[model samples]
Target: MEESKAGDLFAEGVVKHYEPELKKVEKQLNELTSKQSSLLKELQKENVKFSSIDITELTSLYQMMKEYHCRLIAMKKDILAAAERSEKLKNRAMKLKEYKQNIALENAHYREAQMKREQDLIGKPGQPL
Candidate 1:
């Protein structure tokens, strides 16, 4: 019973530890999404303004678009990595919970067997159970 309680506590701790990381990743993804939206709007505006053939201005806009694309890609990768880590932690917690349940089931079976033994002893005197 104590061991099961300990396992539960450990699993809870693990879950709590991952919660902050999950929230952080979600926040970062939200921020990135907002930035991406702004960049898309900027890109659309720049494309409209590109009617004048200024090579230097076109080059600057192209570079800005590329940087925005790169950052968005990197943010997506980070989000995926964080999601994978969170899933792993959840799986670990599930396994720990299963282990504790198995222990409790085993303990219940042992207690039942002890009770049966005691009952048998009451029926039969000076007999080894």
Candidate 2:
């Protein structure tokens, strides 16, 4: 019984750990995706109104575009890693569920045994009136 309870706690700990990791990855992904999207919108706005811009401004815009491209690449890698970790998190949750169910079953068996013993004691024919 103690062993079963310990196993349940260990499984719960594993699930708790992976859940935070998954949230961190998700937050990072959201930041990167949002930055890339904002850059795209800014570029679109420039396209409609910047054909007559000076050379210095054009150079600055080009640099920003290059940086955005690099960030997008990094974001893609993060998303892939996050997907893999999500699968691991799901498996961990399943294991935790199974461990808890097993413990409950063991506890129920113990209670049922106690009840049977009480019944036997009450029915013993040699007992005092």
Candidate 3:
């Protein structure tokens, strides 16, 4: 039916719209992860030489590492939120597809019944062939 087609299209559109947003968030997460890894490596190297480092420089490095860690956590949360939104859109699309199939099946059954009625009336009293 026209309504079924419209609903399917709408659901697909929503899914398509969210897909780009999901990809962007995932890319951001990947970049943040890479930065986090590099920061960790640097921190490890600094830790190994902690006793020989100047106190002020060490403090500055620690503060910068903490900020990077916080940002990494925020990126991870954004990715999770985006993923959840994308999943919901996908589920809606699937449901719309199922609805379209059901509509088609119902239409088929109705048409078959109408055809059978027409066949039965072909030679009936007062009904034209």
- List model 1 lDDT by residue over 37-94, tens digit each: 9999999889888766789988999999999999999999999999999999999999
lDDT of 3 by residue, 1-115 (tens): 9999999999999999999999999999999999999999999999889768799998999999999999999999999999999999999999999999999999999999999
Q: Give the lDDT of residue 10 in candidate 2.
A: 99
Model 2: how far residue 119 lies from native, Å: 1.3
The most accurate candidate by TM-score is: 3
TM-score of 1: 0.48
Candidate 3: residue 120 lDDT (0-100): 83
CA lDDT scores, all candidates in order: 0.95, 0.95, 0.95
Off by over 4 Å in 3: 1-51, 124-129
Q: Superposing all C-alpha atoms, what RMSD in Å does each candidate have to the true structure?
A: 37.3, 39.0, 37.5
Name the candidate, 2 or 3, with the larger TM-score value: 3
lDDT of 2 at 61: 92
Kindly provide the TM-score of model 3 when superposed on the true structure, using C-alpha atoms.
0.51
Whole-structure CA lDDT of model 2: 0.95
- TM-score rank order: 3, 1, 2
